[model samples]
Target: MITPGSNITDRFAIVREDMHRRYGQYFYADTIDALLDEKIAQAKATAKIETFLPVTVEREVSSELEQRAEAAGRSGTARPEILFVCERNAGRSQLASAITHQAVGDRVFVRSVGLNPSGGIDPQVLEVLQERGVPTGHMYQKEIVPRTVHRASVVVLMGVDEVPGIPGDRVVRWDIADPAGQPIEKVREIADDVEAHVKNLLDELGKTNFNAA
Candidate 1:
């Protein structure tokens, strides 16, 4: 039980006790206090009811912390990386990587490579993503470094015919139509398909609790 001592507000007492009961073994009082402060700060502007603020903040912070703890536990194992490859870096591969990154955050190690090594991302693809409000974080230069393919748990081959298909259950293809240099309508179609596919893949792989990026 927590007493609302001189420094501890009744709200803090409730939140602290709840979190301590839930995760005190994994975190110390000072650390949990810091987390509580951060969570409250994050929710300060929200117009939600006051009666449940502590509960809501505690739930969100605890969930995020639990996920981080689980990821830390798997440090001994090689990170479960997902590699996305396509003919060029501009379109489908980037879209898939961006969607997956957004859904899983850093929970899965995501790397995208282009066999053809295009120097720039396609404008139409960027336009579509912007319309949908997806953040395409860090557009990396595309290159087929041998090490990435060898380390990936799942290697996805997107619409790129030049490279020979990698044979294995771990390697799959999206069969999405390449949108590079395509008309805006065509690019939009490819984007929609990629979004759906990425969502499904995240749901499927989330069972394994992908490494938090």
Candidate 2:
């Protein structure tokens, strides 16, 4: 039988090796290093490692009040409104929103919503974000609303199910693995994945110039 606290590194190594075997391109050392480097650069520039905010909720009128005022009566502005959504409003969604907000600065407005709202934001998520020096102000778990959906420029889905009634063009599915009730190490791994994806998305947005006004 396996010991409770025995070396699990070997097991992890085996799993990693198996993953490499399954996905050769992603498992290569060079590719992994490049991805890590990109994530590091993104984290350094933004000073956060958690997933950035979703693309949809970031465009809400409440979130972009100042931007809206700036373009009052005009056609529109050029910023993107991003919304991050998950099963619960606590962990992953919060991390993604916080990271995105930090990564894009004030240029993009970011918010997070939940299919089934939780009591409050997860403490562990807050702890991880604080460690990365990302401000936690204005972070809270709230229910998804029609207004939230209508306002988002892009809606990122962290959960499995597609958010009902959201427009097809506005939706972006991330399918991030949930980190609830897991060990800190597992949470960190998930965070790293989120960070990588956020960097990729940022790069895509830069190339596409998909921001709305």
Candidate 3:
């Protein structure tokens, strides 16, 4: 007797009554039934599905830095800050941080900080970046303060050691090499690693709606 336009709630009520009558004592009338009923109610409440969304802060920052560096080389201006991060702010973190800043011109900011920052910037890291025409300013080590995190709209983490206590929703990790006492070639490999990660991040950010206000 159900019509197409009949209320769903009324139809369900009728069905439940029929089930109870037919099954009698065999019907699930315990806590399991209650749980199933609750789940069903929740599903009915949220029947519509939502679409997936993506954000790429790290990628945009990397791209912006690269472009700025090229333009700055052509002209002669200071770049903006593009913060690079890792565990100790000495090896992988310092290298990635310096390269990113140098590759991007004065229009972009570039800085590197660490979670447990120790040791000065690695000399080998500095050399590779310099070869790529990226400048290495005074590379001191500092802990990642709240102000540092706030200053960066995009943050890149190079290794597990450098992993900060920041929210995962706002951080990007690139598992690169730790060029402590390794050869110069090994440091270059780490630079390549940083470059690849940065490019991927930029591509991802390009596809997102970052201007959502």
- Which candidate has the top score in lDDT? 1
lDDT computed for candidate 2 = 0.59
Estimate the TM-score for candidate 2. 0.59
lDDT of 1 by residue, 58-121 (tens): 6887787788668777223433557788877778888888767666654566777777776689
Where does model 1 exceed 4 Å of error? Answer: 1-79, 146-150, 162-169, 207-213
Q: Rank the candidates by lDDT, best first.
A: 1, 2, 3
In order, the Cα lDDT scores of the candidates are 0.67, 0.59, 0.54
Tens digits of per-residue lDDT, candidate 2, 1-213, equal 122233333322333322222223223445433443444345447634223311111222123433433465433445566778888888888888888877876556567778888768877777777877778887878775433343567878887475655543477888677888877777777777777777777776673332211
Q: Sort all candidates by TM-score, best to worst.
A: 2, 1, 3
Clashes of each: 5, 20, 20
TM-score, one value per model: 0.56, 0.59, 0.51
The TM-score of predicted model 1 comes to 0.56
Model 3 TM-score, 2 decimals: 0.51
Candidate 3 weakest lDDT stretch, 10 residues: 49-58
Global Cα RMSD, each model: 15.0, 20.4, 24.1
